[model samples]
Target: MSKVKIAVIGCGSIAQHRHLPEYAMNEHVEIVAVCDIVEERVNKVASEYGVIAYTNYEELLADPEIEAVSVCTPNYLHAPISIAALEAGKHVLCEKPMATSSEEAMNMIEAAKKSNKKLMIGHNQRFVASHQKARKLIEDGELGKIYSFRTAFGHGGPEGWSVDGKESWFFKKNEAFIGAMGDLGVHKTDLLRFLLGEEFVEVGAFIETSAKENADVDDTAVCILRTESGIIGTLAASWSYVSKEDNSTVIYGEKAILRLEEDPVHNLILQYKNGEVVKCELGGIQTNEEGGQTTSHVISHFVQSIISDTIPPVPGEEGMKSLQVILAALESKETSKIITIN
Candidate 1:
C-alpha cells in the first residue's frame, strides 16, 4: 500500500464537484476507479480524473487494490454498496442521511463491525471550519446549557445543482427515498447532533410537496427536535428557496445565543450573552472551479482512521443516530405526533 488506492462508487454531481476533486488534492491517495450505474457519467468522470470507470459498483468493489471506496450513490443504494465495500475489506465513506431507513443504516454498521473495516459517513458540515469552531465553543461550555437551536439547508432545487437537471435522481423517490428531508434535511440533522453533542429523544415534523410543482416527494419540511439532554430545536430543509439559503443552527444557552451562518450571512456567526459577536468564515469556500476540493478533508480523515485503527468522527453508529432522528421525524409527520428515538 504505497498510497491508499481509492475508488469512487458514484459519478454524480457530488463525486464530480466534491469527492473526486478532493482526492486529487491528497498526495497519499490514488483514485483507481470511478463507478456509476450510468455508463456515460462513469466514463466522463473517469476521463476527467484519468481513472478506470465501471457501470457496476460491485466490479469496483471487487478490485483488491482499492483500499477504500467513497459511496456517492443515491440514498437508497448507500447501505448496500457501503456494506459490500466493507465486506470486501475496503474502507467506506458513505454520503449523508446514512441510509434510506434506520434499519438499513444499522445493517451497514453491523457489516463494518463484522469486517473490522472503517466506515465514515459523509457529514461534511462537521468538516467545515466554522462548524468545528462552534463545536469547540459548545464543548468548552461557552454556551452553557444549550436550551434550543434552529437551522436550515435549502436551495432553489435539485435541478440547479444536479448534472441531470430536473430529471435528476433526487426527484425520484425510489432512488432518493425521501426528497428534501433526506437530501437537505440530513445535513442539518447531522450538524445539529454534532453541535449539541446529544441524540434526539423525540421528533415532531411536517413535510409537504408544496413547491417544485412537478415532484413526487417533499419540496419543503420543518421538524422540531428534543435531544436526550433536554435541548430543543427546529430544523428545516427545502428545494424552494429562490436564492440558496444554507443558514443553520442558532443555539440559545444560559450564557449566550450562538447564531451560525449569520454574517455575510453565508458564514457562521457566534453571539455571546455578554454582547460579544464572533464571525468566522467557513472552510471549502467554493469561489471557483477548485472550491470543492476540500471534500478530500473528509476522505483523508477516513483514511487516517483506517491507518490508526480508530473510529471515525462520523462512524456508522454515529451516523445512524442522525438517521434515527430523521426517521423519527418522518414518523412524526405521518402520525401527526411526536415520535421518540428509542
Candidate 2:
C-alpha cells in the first residue's frame, strides 16, 4: 500500500510533540504539508518534516494529493477546518475538545457523513493500555456492576507550552472558548464515557478561575455528572495545580474499586471486597519529548484505522459525545443547575 499522505493544519505544541513525531515513526504515513497561521511555525515544521508549508489552511486543504488532515488548530476553528478538509476529500483527525459548542461539533460530524470520510478526534486516553485493560475487565464482568467514577486532568498552565506563551489562544476567550475544562476535562469526560460505556445525561458544575492569576477562563473547575445508566461521579480539571496531576480515573463497582494513573507507573490497581488488592503495571504506551512520556498508542490506532478502513475507537460522533459532556458542564456552571445533554 502507498503511504497515507497527511497534511497537518496546525504547527503548535501538540502538532510538534505528539502528531508530527508519531507520523515520523509510522511507516505508513507521509507528512506532505504543514499549515499554521504563523509562518515561522509552519516553516520550521515543514523544514523538519521535509514537507511544503502553508500559512493559509485553505491552500493546504486544496491540495488533492493529501489523503488526510490533522486539524490541530485552536478550539474555535476545529469544526470549520475539519468540515472544509472533509469536503475537500480528505479524512480528518481533529484534536479534542472537538469543538467549542455542541452545534459546531454536530456540523463537523455531518460534514464527515456527507463526505463519506473517516473523522476521528485526538482523545488519546482511550488508547492507554491500563485504561484499555480496565475497560475490558468491566466488560468481562470482573468489576461486577460498576457504580461510580471520578476522573481528573490538571496541569500548571499553558504559558510554558503554547506558542504565544501566556498570551496564547488558550487564554483568549474567542480562541479557546473554555479553559481548563475544555483543555483537560474533555479528555476525562471522553475517557469516562469510553470506559464506563455510558453517555452523560446531566451535569452540575462549578467552573472558576481560581489560580491562573489573570486568565479570562477557568483555571479550576469541578463537575458532577449523571450518566444515562444512572451512574454518577465527578470530573475535576485545573491549570492551577502547582504539581501537575496526569489524568487519572477511579471506578467503584459492586465487587471492587479500580484506580488508574498515567504517571510514575502507568498501571491499574483493583481493591476487592474480600480485602484483596491487585496491581497491574503496563508502561511505555506514550511518550513526551522531555522527561515525561505519555501513551502514543492512539497514533498507532489511527494509522491502523486508516489502513484497514475500520472505525476508530474515538470516532467523530464518539468525540462529539465527549464534547457534549464538557459543554454541558459549562452550561451547568452558567445556569447553576443540572444541565441536560439532549
Candidate 3:
C-alpha cells in the first residue's frame, strides 16, 4: 500500500486535538473513517477531516479500506476495540493507560501477536524531545550510577480537557476504571521505564480524591516504585494543580542530577556534583493539560513503523509493562501494602 488508510474510533477531544490533526499532517496516511457513539461528534470530525463517520466503531472496523485504526475511545473500551481492529487485519494505535487492567492489556498484546499487526500505544510522553534527550543522556552514562529518580505529572483536572467537561467519562469509575493515576500516572510510569530501561518490580501507593469536588475518581496519588534493577523512585499523578502543571522528572546520580522539564525556560538541565550546570533547550514537551497535545512525534513514529514494517518503539508489550506498574499501584493502594509485579 502506497498510503496507509486509517480510521479514528473516537471523535472526542484527544481524537480531535491530537490524533486527527497528526493524521492529517502525515502524508503517508489517509483519514478514511471516524467513529463515535455520539453521532454529532462523529459527524463533525468526519466533516472536518473529509472522512466517513460511523456511530458504531464496529462498523468502521469492518471497512476493508482502512489499514490502521486509532482506538481513541474510553479507557474500558481500549482493549476490546484494539483487539477487534487487530483481528480485522488493521494496525492499532491505542490511547494511553492501554487498558483499565493488566489482563485487558495482555489480551490486546496477544491479539496483536496472533494477527501479526502493529499495536502501538499512544504514550506521547515518551516522544517528547526533552524526554528523548534525557534518555540519551542516561544511556550515555553521563549521570553515572543512577541512585534514584522522581517523576510527576500534574494538571488542573480532566474537567478542563475532556470533551464533555464535567460530565465526561473520565470522572466516572465505571468508564474510567481509574482516576488521575491512570490518566497521568501511567504516563509517568511509562516515561520512567523508558528513561531507566527497566521494569518496575514492586509498587506502594497512596491514592485518594483530594480535589475535583464533583468527581468520584481520585484527583491525587503518590506511588513508590522499585524497578527490577533495584532502582527506587516516587511517581506522582495529580489533577489538583490549580496554579500550573508540573510535568517534570529529576534523576539523581552519583555524578550529576539530570532534570527534565523542571525549568520553564530550559527543557533540560544537568547539575553536576562539582559545581557545574549545563542547560539545554531542545523543544517543548508534548504533554498538555488544556487538551492541546500537539508537537508530538508519536504519530510519525507509528506511521514509520507501518511504512517500514518495523516494530513500534512503544509496542503493545511495552505499553502493557507500563500499565502493569499502575495496576500494581492500584492493588497496593487498595490493600494498604506493597504489591509485587510478578
- Tens digits of per-residue lDDT, candidate 1, 1-342, equal 577899998888888877888888877788899998889878888898899989988877888899999999888899999989999999999998789887898899899989988999988778777778889999999889888888887878888778898888898888888888988898788888888888889999999998886688888999988988898888999888776455566889998888776555346666777788777666533321333434536777887787777999899988888888888888998899989889
In model 1, what is the error at residue 173, expressed in angstroms? 0.9
By lDDT, highest first, what's the ranking?
A: 3, 2, 1
Candidate 3: count of backbone clashes, pairs at least 3 residues apart or interchain: 0
Each prediction's TM-score versus the true structure: 0.94, 0.96, 0.97
Q: What digit string (tens of lDDT, one per residue) describes model 3 on residues 133-214?
A: 9899999999998889999999889888889999999999888989999899999999999999888899999999988877
Model 1 alpha-carbon miss at residue 91, Å: 1.0
Model 2, runs deviating above 4 Å: 284-289
Worst 10 residues of 1 by lDDT: 284-293
* C-alpha lDDT (0 to 100) for residue 243 of candidate 1: 63
List the candidate 1 regions with Cα displacement exceeding 4 Å. 265-268, 281-296
Model 2 vs. true fold: TM: 0.96
Candidate 2, residues 155-196: lDDT per residue as tens digits?
Answer: 788877787788788987888998999988998898898899
lDDT of each: 0.83, 0.86, 0.90
| Candidate 2 residue pairs that clash | 285-295, 285-296, 286-294, 286-295, 286-296, 287-294, 288-293
